[model samples]
Target: MRPSSALVLAFAASTLAQDQIPLVDKVKGWFAQATAAVTSAVPAAASSPVASGRAKVAETIQHPLTLENWKETLTVDPSASTPTTQEWLVYITGGNATCFGFCGNATKAWNASLPFLAAKPNAPKFAVIDCDAEPLLCNSWSVGPPSLYYFQIPKPLADQSAPAATVRYQPLNRTSTTVDTFKKLVLDNDFEKVEPYEGYFHPFNGELQQYGLALPLAYVMWGFSKMPSWLPMILISFMSRTFM
Candidate 1:
Protein backbone atom coordinates (compact mmCIF):
# COMPACT_ATOMS: atom_id res chain seq x y z
CA MET A 1 0.00 0.00 0.00
CA ARG A 2 1.18 3.53 -0.96
CA PRO A 3 1.74 6.05 1.81
CA SER A 4 -0.76 8.93 1.98
CA SER A 5 0.32 12.49 0.85
CA ALA A 6 -0.13 13.80 4.43
CA LEU A 7 2.39 11.25 5.74
CA VAL A 8 4.88 12.20 2.96
CA LEU A 9 4.54 15.92 3.77
CA ALA A 10 4.95 15.27 7.49
CA PHE A 11 8.10 13.19 6.82
CA ALA A 12 9.58 15.97 4.63
CA ALA A 13 8.88 18.60 7.26
CA SER A 14 10.51 16.46 9.98
CA THR A 15 13.61 15.96 7.81
CA LEU A 16 13.92 19.73 7.11
CA ALA A 17 13.59 20.54 10.80
CA GLN A 18 16.27 18.01 11.69
CA ASP A 19 18.67 19.35 8.99
CA GLN A 20 18.40 23.04 10.07
CA ILE A 21 19.38 24.51 13.41
CA PRO A 22 16.72 26.33 15.43
CA LEU A 23 16.97 30.15 15.57
CA VAL A 24 17.39 29.99 19.35
CA ASP A 25 20.28 27.52 19.09
CA LYS A 26 22.02 29.62 16.42
CA VAL A 27 21.82 32.68 18.66
CA LYS A 28 23.28 30.70 21.56
CA GLY A 29 26.17 29.49 19.41
CA TRP A 30 26.97 33.03 18.23
CA PHE A 31 26.91 34.34 21.81
CA ALA A 32 29.24 31.57 22.94
CA GLN A 33 31.73 32.38 20.17
CA ALA A 34 31.68 36.13 21.01
CA THR A 35 32.18 35.42 24.72
CA ALA A 36 35.13 33.14 23.97
CA ALA A 37 36.73 35.75 21.72
CA VAL A 38 36.39 38.47 24.38
CA THR A 39 37.76 36.15 27.06
CA SER A 40 40.81 35.27 24.95
CA ALA A 41 41.47 38.93 24.15
CA VAL A 42 41.44 40.05 27.80
CA PRO A 43 44.69 38.28 28.68
CA ALA A 44 46.48 39.59 25.60
CA ALA A 45 45.36 43.13 26.31
CA ALA A 46 46.28 42.88 29.97
CA SER A 47 49.80 41.75 29.10
CA SER A 48 50.38 44.55 26.60
CA PRO A 49 53.16 46.91 27.67
CA VAL A 50 51.62 49.84 25.81
CA ALA A 51 48.37 49.43 27.69
CA SER A 52 50.11 49.23 31.06
CA GLY A 53 52.30 52.21 30.28
CA ARG A 54 49.36 54.35 29.31
CA ALA A 55 47.55 53.39 32.49
CA LYS A 56 50.56 54.31 34.59
CA VAL A 57 50.94 57.64 32.82
CA ALA A 58 47.31 58.49 33.42
CA GLU A 59 47.44 57.58 37.10
CA THR A 60 50.78 59.06 38.08
CA ILE A 61 51.72 61.65 35.49
CA GLN A 62 48.48 63.42 34.63
CA HIS A 63 46.89 64.20 37.94
CA PRO A 64 43.51 65.88 37.53
CA LEU A 65 43.10 68.86 39.84
CA THR A 66 39.63 69.74 41.01
CA LEU A 67 38.17 71.77 43.82
CA GLU A 68 38.16 68.76 46.12
CA ASN A 69 41.70 67.57 45.39
CA TRP A 70 43.20 71.03 44.86
CA LYS A 71 44.75 71.08 48.32
CA GLU A 72 46.26 67.63 47.93
CA THR A 73 48.04 68.83 44.81
CA LEU A 74 49.66 71.62 46.79
CA THR A 75 50.45 69.47 49.84
CA VAL A 76 52.71 66.47 50.29
CA ASP A 77 51.56 63.16 51.68
CA PRO A 78 52.59 62.72 55.33
CA SER A 79 52.64 58.96 54.96
CA ALA A 80 55.72 59.01 52.76
CA SER A 81 59.01 57.99 54.42
CA THR A 82 60.94 60.70 52.64
CA PRO A 83 59.87 64.24 51.85
CA THR A 84 59.22 64.79 48.13
CA THR A 85 60.41 68.03 46.61
CA GLN A 86 58.33 67.70 43.47
CA GLU A 87 56.65 70.94 42.45
CA TRP A 88 53.36 71.18 40.57
CA LEU A 89 52.72 72.09 36.94
CA VAL A 90 49.06 72.87 36.49
CA TYR A 91 47.55 73.14 33.02
CA ILE A 92 44.24 74.92 33.19
CA THR A 93 42.04 74.36 30.18
CA GLY A 94 38.47 75.31 29.28
CA GLY A 95 35.67 72.82 29.15
CA ASN A 96 34.37 71.47 25.86
CA ALA A 97 31.31 73.66 26.17
CA THR A 98 33.17 76.84 27.10
CA CYS A 99 36.39 76.37 25.15
CA PHE A 100 37.49 79.38 23.19
CA GLY A 101 39.04 79.02 19.73
CA PHE A 102 42.52 79.57 21.19
CA CYS A 103 42.55 76.40 23.28
CA GLY A 104 43.22 74.02 20.36
CA ASN A 105 46.90 74.74 19.90
CA ALA A 106 47.58 75.03 23.62
CA THR A 107 45.78 71.76 24.33
CA LYS A 108 47.75 69.95 21.68
CA ALA A 109 51.03 71.28 23.02
CA TRP A 110 50.06 70.31 26.56
CA ASN A 111 49.22 66.74 25.57
CA ALA A 112 52.38 66.32 23.51
CA SER A 113 54.47 67.36 26.48
CA LEU A 114 52.96 64.66 28.70
CA PRO A 115 55.03 61.72 27.48
CA PHE A 116 58.22 63.76 27.38
CA LEU A 117 57.49 65.26 30.77
CA ALA A 118 56.73 61.85 32.25
CA ALA A 119 60.11 60.54 31.07
CA LYS A 120 62.12 63.39 32.57
CA PRO A 121 63.87 62.77 35.89
CA ASN A 122 62.54 64.76 38.84
CA ALA A 123 59.70 66.11 36.71
CA PRO A 124 57.15 68.39 38.30
CA LYS A 125 53.85 66.84 39.35
CA PHE A 126 51.70 67.45 36.28
CA ALA A 127 48.09 68.31 36.96
CA VAL A 128 45.23 69.57 34.79
CA ILE A 129 42.28 71.67 35.89
CA ASP A 130 39.16 72.02 33.80
CA CYS A 131 37.70 75.50 34.08
CA ASP A 132 34.19 74.44 33.24
CA ALA A 133 34.22 71.82 35.98
CA GLU A 134 35.66 74.12 38.63
CA PRO A 135 34.80 77.65 37.65
CA LEU A 136 35.12 79.00 41.16
CA LEU A 137 38.52 77.40 41.60
CA CYS A 138 39.72 78.71 38.27
CA ASN A 139 38.39 82.15 39.08
CA SER A 140 40.21 82.11 42.39
CA TRP A 141 43.46 81.86 40.51
CA SER A 142 42.49 84.99 38.53
CA VAL A 143 43.94 83.40 35.40
CA GLY A 144 42.22 82.50 32.15
CA PRO A 145 41.94 79.05 30.65
CA PRO A 146 44.59 77.55 28.37
CA SER A 147 47.17 78.87 30.78
CA LEU A 148 49.96 77.04 32.67
CA TYR A 149 50.81 77.63 36.31
CA TYR A 150 53.88 76.41 38.18
CA PHE A 151 53.53 76.15 41.91
CA GLN A 152 56.42 75.63 44.27
CA ILE A 153 54.61 73.91 47.08
CA PRO A 154 56.16 74.31 50.52
CA LYS A 155 57.89 71.38 52.17
CA PRO A 156 56.44 69.52 55.18
CA LEU A 157 53.09 69.38 53.34
CA ALA A 158 51.43 69.63 56.73
CA ASP A 159 52.15 73.33 56.88
CA GLN A 160 49.00 74.78 55.37
CA SER A 161 49.86 78.25 56.54
CA ALA A 162 52.87 78.61 54.28
CA PRO A 163 52.33 80.47 51.03
CA ALA A 164 53.06 78.63 47.78
CA ALA A 165 55.08 80.21 44.98
CA THR A 166 53.06 80.52 41.75
CA VAL A 167 54.17 81.58 38.30
CA ARG A 168 52.52 81.75 34.89
CA TYR A 169 54.03 80.48 31.67
CA GLN A 170 54.19 83.02 28.89
CA PRO A 171 52.18 82.45 25.73
CA LEU A 172 54.04 80.67 22.93
CA ASN A 173 53.22 79.80 19.36
CA ARG A 174 53.05 76.39 17.67
CA THR A 175 52.82 73.05 19.43
CA SER A 176 56.47 72.06 18.86
CA THR A 177 57.82 75.37 20.14
CA THR A 178 55.46 75.36 23.07
CA VAL A 179 56.53 71.83 24.00
CA ASP A 180 60.20 72.83 23.89
CA THR A 181 59.54 75.96 25.95
CA PHE A 182 57.57 73.96 28.53
CA LYS A 183 60.36 71.39 28.85
CA LYS A 184 62.89 74.14 29.33
CA LEU A 185 60.72 75.85 31.90
CA VAL A 186 60.50 72.70 33.97
CA LEU A 187 64.11 71.65 33.48
CA ASP A 188 65.79 74.99 34.02
CA ASN A 189 63.46 75.96 36.87
CA ASP A 190 63.54 79.53 35.62
CA PHE A 191 60.92 81.99 36.84
CA GLU A 192 62.73 85.08 35.65
CA LYS A 193 61.27 84.88 32.16
CA VAL A 194 57.79 83.92 33.28
CA GLU A 195 55.45 86.29 35.07
CA PRO A 196 54.47 85.61 38.67
CA TYR A 197 50.81 84.77 39.32
CA GLU A 198 49.60 87.49 41.66
CA GLY A 199 46.06 86.21 42.00
CA TYR A 200 44.72 85.17 45.40
CA PHE A 201 44.05 81.44 45.79
CA HIS A 202 41.24 81.85 48.27
CA PRO A 203 37.89 80.55 47.02
CA PHE A 204 35.83 82.86 49.24
CA ASN A 205 37.58 85.90 47.82
CA GLY A 206 36.73 84.87 44.31
CA GLU A 207 33.12 84.24 45.22
CA LEU A 208 32.87 87.63 46.88
CA GLN A 209 34.44 89.38 43.90
CA GLN A 210 32.13 87.61 41.46
CA TYR A 211 29.08 88.50 43.49
CA GLY A 212 30.19 92.11 43.78
CA LEU A 213 30.32 92.46 40.02
CA ALA A 214 27.25 90.38 39.36
CA LEU A 215 24.95 92.17 41.82
CA PRO A 216 25.02 95.47 39.95
CA LEU A 217 24.32 93.79 36.62
CA ALA A 218 21.62 91.70 38.23
CA TYR A 219 19.91 94.81 39.62
CA VAL A 220 19.99 96.52 36.23
CA MET A 221 18.57 93.45 34.53
CA TRP A 222 15.83 93.25 37.13
CA GLY A 223 14.95 96.90 36.58
CA PHE A 224 14.78 96.36 32.81
CA SER A 225 12.76 93.21 33.20
CA LYS A 226 10.15 95.03 35.26
CA MET A 227 9.87 97.91 32.76
CA PRO A 228 7.14 97.97 30.11
CA SER A 229 8.13 96.27 26.85
CA TRP A 230 7.25 99.45 24.90
CA LEU A 231 9.34 101.62 27.23
CA PRO A 232 12.59 100.79 25.40
CA MET A 233 11.15 101.95 22.05
CA ILE A 234 9.90 105.19 23.59
CA LEU A 235 13.26 105.75 25.29
CA ILE A 236 15.09 105.14 21.99
CA SER A 237 12.79 107.63 20.21
CA PHE A 238 13.33 110.21 22.94
CA MET A 239 17.10 109.76 22.80
CA SER A 240 17.09 110.08 18.99
CA ARG A 241 15.10 113.34 19.14
CA THR A 242 17.38 114.76 21.83
CA PHE A 243 20.50 113.84 19.84
CA MET A 244 18.98 115.34 16.63
Candidate 2:
Protein backbone atom coordinates (compact mmCIF):
# COMPACT_ATOMS: atom_id res chain seq x y z
CA MET A 1 0.00 0.00 0.00
CA ARG A 2 1.12 3.57 -0.57
CA PRO A 3 2.41 5.33 2.60
CA SER A 4 -0.18 8.17 2.33
CA SER A 5 -3.01 5.59 1.94
CA ALA A 6 -1.70 3.66 4.96
CA LEU A 7 -1.81 6.81 7.12
CA VAL A 8 -5.41 7.56 5.99
CA LEU A 9 -6.47 4.00 6.77
CA ALA A 10 -4.97 4.22 10.27
CA PHE A 11 -6.82 7.50 10.94
CA ALA A 12 -10.10 5.97 9.75
CA ALA A 13 -9.57 2.95 12.01
CA SER A 14 -9.09 5.23 15.03
CA THR A 15 -12.28 7.19 14.20
CA LEU A 16 -14.26 3.91 13.78
CA ALA A 17 -12.93 2.59 17.11
CA GLN A 18 -14.07 5.75 18.90
CA ASP A 19 -17.54 5.48 17.44
CA GLN A 20 -17.76 1.76 18.21
CA ILE A 21 -17.56 2.11 22.03
CA PRO A 22 -19.88 -0.38 23.83
CA LEU A 23 -23.45 0.79 24.55
CA VAL A 24 -23.24 -0.34 28.21
CA ASP A 25 -20.07 1.76 28.75
CA LYS A 26 -21.80 4.85 27.33
CA VAL A 27 -24.84 4.22 29.60
CA LYS A 28 -22.56 3.85 32.63
CA GLY A 29 -20.85 7.15 31.85
CA TRP A 30 -24.22 8.91 31.61
CA PHE A 31 -25.38 7.35 34.91
CA ALA A 32 -22.24 8.49 36.69
CA GLN A 33 -22.76 12.08 35.55
CA ALA A 34 -26.38 12.01 36.68
CA THR A 35 -25.41 10.58 40.09
CA ALA A 36 -22.73 13.27 40.56
CA ALA A 37 -25.23 16.02 39.75
CA VAL A 38 -27.77 14.65 42.25
CA THR A 39 -25.14 14.25 44.95
CA SER A 40 -24.01 17.85 44.52
CA ALA A 41 -27.62 19.08 44.58
CA VAL A 42 -28.54 17.34 47.87
CA PRO A 43 -26.65 19.63 50.26
CA ALA A 44 -28.05 22.72 48.60
CA ALA A 45 -31.55 21.30 48.75
CA ALA A 46 -31.10 20.42 52.42
CA SER A 47 -30.11 23.99 53.28
CA SER A 48 -32.95 25.51 51.28
CA PRO A 49 -35.57 27.93 52.64
CA VAL A 50 -37.97 25.15 53.67
CA ALA A 51 -35.38 23.59 55.94
CA SER A 52 -34.18 26.90 57.38
CA GLY A 53 -37.78 27.94 57.97
CA ARG A 54 -38.44 24.77 59.95
CA ALA A 55 -35.36 25.40 62.06
CA LYS A 56 -36.52 28.94 62.71
CA VAL A 57 -39.98 27.74 63.71
CA ALA A 58 -38.50 25.19 66.10
CA GLU A 59 -36.35 27.85 67.76
CA THR A 60 -39.06 30.50 68.03
CA ILE A 61 -42.21 28.50 68.76
CA GLN A 62 -41.54 25.33 70.73
CA HIS A 63 -40.63 25.59 74.42
CA PRO A 64 -38.30 22.97 75.84
CA LEU A 65 -40.31 20.99 78.40
CA THR A 66 -38.02 19.89 81.21
CA LEU A 67 -38.69 18.46 84.67
CA GLU A 68 -38.06 21.90 86.19
CA ASN A 69 -40.58 23.78 84.04
CA TRP A 70 -43.19 21.10 83.36
CA LYS A 71 -45.56 22.19 86.13
CA GLU A 72 -45.34 25.91 85.31
CA THR A 73 -45.81 25.05 81.66
CA LEU A 74 -48.72 22.62 82.07
CA THR A 75 -50.81 23.83 85.04
CA VAL A 76 -52.84 26.97 85.64
CA ASP A 77 -53.61 29.03 88.76
CA PRO A 78 -57.19 28.54 89.99
CA SER A 79 -57.13 31.07 92.85
CA ALA A 80 -56.73 34.09 90.60
CA SER A 81 -60.05 35.90 90.21
CA THR A 82 -59.28 36.41 86.53
CA PRO A 83 -57.93 32.96 85.74
CA THR A 84 -56.52 32.58 82.27
CA THR A 85 -57.76 29.70 80.18
CA GLN A 86 -54.77 27.80 78.85
CA GLU A 87 -53.94 24.22 77.89
CA TRP A 88 -50.83 22.40 76.71
CA LEU A 89 -49.71 20.53 73.61
CA VAL A 90 -46.59 18.55 74.23
CA TYR A 91 -44.37 16.85 71.66
CA ILE A 92 -42.19 14.19 73.18
CA THR A 93 -39.27 12.74 71.25
CA GLY A 94 -35.94 11.03 71.74
CA GLY A 95 -32.65 12.93 71.58
CA ASN A 96 -31.22 13.86 68.20
CA ALA A 97 -28.20 11.63 68.77
CA THR A 98 -30.36 8.58 69.58
CA CYS A 99 -33.44 9.28 67.41
CA PHE A 100 -34.49 6.73 64.82
CA GLY A 101 -37.44 5.39 62.82
CA PHE A 102 -40.30 7.94 62.67
CA CYS A 103 -38.66 10.48 65.00
CA GLY A 104 -37.24 12.64 62.17
CA ASN A 105 -40.45 12.86 60.17
CA ALA A 106 -42.60 13.21 63.29
CA THR A 107 -40.47 16.11 64.54
CA LYS A 108 -40.61 17.80 61.17
CA ALA A 109 -44.39 17.61 61.18
CA TRP A 110 -44.57 18.95 64.75
CA ASN A 111 -42.33 21.89 63.86
CA ALA A 112 -44.34 22.64 60.72
CA SER A 113 -47.60 22.87 62.70
CA LEU A 114 -46.27 25.43 65.16
CA PRO A 115 -46.70 28.54 63.02
CA PHE A 116 -50.33 27.75 62.29
CA LEU A 117 -51.07 26.89 65.93
CA ALA A 118 -49.27 29.96 67.25
CA ALA A 119 -51.21 32.27 64.94
CA LYS A 120 -54.57 31.30 66.44
CA PRO A 121 -56.19 33.18 69.33
CA ASN A 122 -56.15 31.40 72.70
CA ALA A 123 -53.79 28.88 71.17
CA PRO A 124 -52.71 26.05 73.41
CA LYS A 125 -49.19 26.31 74.80
CA PHE A 126 -46.56 24.29 72.88
CA ALA A 127 -43.87 22.30 74.65
CA VAL A 128 -41.43 19.58 73.65
CA ILE A 129 -39.63 16.99 75.76
CA ASP A 130 -36.51 15.14 74.69
CA CYS A 131 -36.93 11.69 76.22
CA ASP A 132 -33.18 11.21 76.22
CA ALA A 133 -32.85 14.38 78.31
CA GLU A 134 -35.83 13.91 80.64
CA PRO A 135 -36.11 10.16 80.94
CA LEU A 136 -37.57 10.32 84.44
CA LEU A 137 -40.33 12.74 83.46
CA CYS A 138 -41.16 10.69 80.37
CA ASN A 139 -41.12 7.45 82.31
CA SER A 140 -43.45 8.81 84.99
CA TRP A 141 -45.90 9.65 82.26
CA SER A 142 -45.49 6.20 80.67
CA VAL A 143 -44.90 8.02 77.39
CA GLY A 144 -42.69 6.79 74.60
CA PRO A 145 -40.78 9.16 72.38
CA PRO A 146 -42.15 10.72 69.19
CA SER A 147 -45.62 11.03 70.71
CA LEU A 148 -48.04 13.99 70.95
CA TYR A 149 -50.18 14.66 74.01
CA TYR A 150 -52.86 17.33 74.39
CA PHE A 151 -53.61 18.29 78.00
CA GLN A 152 -56.85 19.98 79.06
CA ILE A 153 -56.30 21.05 82.63
CA PRO A 154 -59.55 21.62 84.49
CA LYS A 155 -60.27 24.46 86.90
CA PRO A 156 -59.16 24.30 90.56
CA LEU A 157 -55.93 22.98 89.06
CA ALA A 158 -54.51 22.54 92.53
CA ASP A 159 -57.47 20.58 93.87
CA GLN A 160 -57.76 18.33 90.83
CA SER A 161 -54.95 16.22 92.26
CA ALA A 162 -55.44 13.59 89.60
CA PRO A 163 -53.50 13.48 86.36
CA ALA A 164 -55.00 15.95 83.89
CA ALA A 165 -57.26 14.78 81.07
CA THR A 166 -55.32 14.34 77.87
CA VAL A 167 -55.68 13.06 74.35
CA ARG A 168 -52.85 11.47 72.41
CA TYR A 169 -52.34 11.88 68.70
CA GLN A 170 -51.58 8.53 67.16
CA PRO A 171 -51.24 8.57 63.41
CA LEU A 172 -50.66 5.63 61.12
CA ASN A 173 -48.12 7.61 59.13
CA ARG A 174 -46.08 10.76 59.42
CA THR A 175 -47.20 13.35 56.88
CA SER A 176 -48.66 16.81 56.35
CA THR A 177 -52.04 15.36 57.26
CA THR A 178 -50.76 14.72 60.77
CA VAL A 179 -49.57 18.31 60.97
CA ASP A 180 -52.96 19.61 59.92
CA THR A 181 -54.74 17.43 62.45
CA PHE A 182 -52.45 18.61 65.20
CA LYS A 183 -53.12 22.25 64.42
CA LYS A 184 -56.84 21.64 64.15
CA LEU A 185 -56.98 19.84 67.47
CA VAL A 186 -55.23 22.69 69.24
CA LEU A 187 -57.29 25.44 67.64
CA ASP A 188 -60.63 23.72 68.10
CA ASN A 189 -59.89 22.63 71.70
CA ASP A 190 -61.89 19.56 70.82
CA PHE A 191 -61.28 16.93 73.48
CA GLU A 192 -64.64 15.20 73.33
CA LYS A 193 -62.83 11.91 73.65
CA VAL A 194 -60.41 12.63 76.46
CA GLU A 195 -58.75 10.00 78.67
CA PRO A 196 -57.20 10.32 82.10
CA TYR A 197 -53.42 10.37 81.86
CA GLU A 198 -52.40 6.85 82.80
CA GLY A 199 -49.21 8.36 84.16
CA TYR A 200 -49.19 9.76 87.70
CA PHE A 201 -48.48 13.34 88.73
CA HIS A 202 -45.24 13.92 90.62
CA PRO A 203 -47.25 14.91 93.71
CA PHE A 204 -49.16 11.65 93.64
CA ASN A 205 -48.16 8.15 92.51
CA GLY A 206 -45.21 9.46 90.54
CA GLU A 207 -43.46 10.75 93.65
CA LEU A 208 -43.81 7.40 95.38
CA GLN A 209 -42.53 5.56 92.30
CA GLN A 210 -39.57 7.93 92.14
CA TYR A 211 -38.72 7.20 95.79
CA GLY A 212 -39.11 3.48 95.14
CA LEU A 213 -36.70 3.74 92.21
CA ALA A 214 -34.17 5.58 94.36
CA LEU A 215 -34.44 3.21 97.37
CA PRO A 216 -31.80 0.82 96.03
CA LEU A 217 -29.36 3.65 95.32
CA ALA A 218 -30.12 5.17 98.72
CA TYR A 219 -29.45 1.84 100.41
CA VAL A 220 -26.13 1.51 98.60
CA MET A 221 -25.15 5.00 99.67
CA TRP A 222 -26.14 4.25 103.26
CA GLY A 223 -24.04 1.10 103.21
CA PHE A 224 -21.13 3.11 101.87
CA SER A 225 -21.57 5.70 104.61
CA LYS A 226 -21.37 2.98 107.28
CA MET A 227 -18.18 1.53 105.76
CA PRO A 228 -14.74 2.79 106.82
CA SER A 229 -13.35 5.46 104.45
CA TRP A 230 -10.25 3.29 104.01
CA LEU A 231 -12.36 0.42 102.59
CA PRO A 232 -13.29 2.21 99.37
CA MET A 233 -9.70 3.29 98.81
CA ILE A 234 -8.50 -0.31 99.30
CA LEU A 235 -11.21 -1.64 96.99
CA ILE A 236 -10.31 0.91 94.33
CA SER A 237 -6.60 0.00 94.59
CA PHE A 238 -7.39 -3.71 94.36
CA MET A 239 -9.62 -3.16 91.28
CA SER A 240 -6.93 -1.07 89.60
CA ARG A 241 -4.30 -3.74 90.28
CA THR A 242 -6.58 -6.49 88.96
CA PHE A 243 -7.35 -4.57 85.81
CA MET A 244 -3.64 -3.81 85.29
Index of the highest-TM-score prediction:
2
| Candidate 2 residue spans exceeding 4 A from truth | 1-46, 77-84, 95-101, 154-177, 188-191, 198-244
* Error at 192, model 2, angstroms: 3.3
Q: Candidate 2: what lDDT?
A: 0.58
Which lDDT values do the candidates have, in the order given?
A: 0.57, 0.58
- Give me the displacement of residue 159 in model 1, in angstroms: 8.1
Per-residue lDDT of candidate 1, residues 109-196 (tens digit) = 6776678876768667778877767655665454456777776654544544444444555544423346666677766655457766
How many pairs in model 1 have backbone atoms within 3 A of each other, for residues 3 or more apart or on separate chains, i.e. clashes?
Answer: 0
lDDT of 2 by residue, 143-217 (tens): 556677776665454454444344444332332446766655666654445454444333223444556653343
For each candidate in turn, the TM-score is 0.51, 0.54
> Which candidate has the highest lDDT of all?
2
Question: How many clashing residue pairs appear in each of the predictions shown?
Answer: 0, 0
Q: For each candidate in turn, give its C-alpha RMSD to the true structure in angstroms.
A: 25.5, 23.9
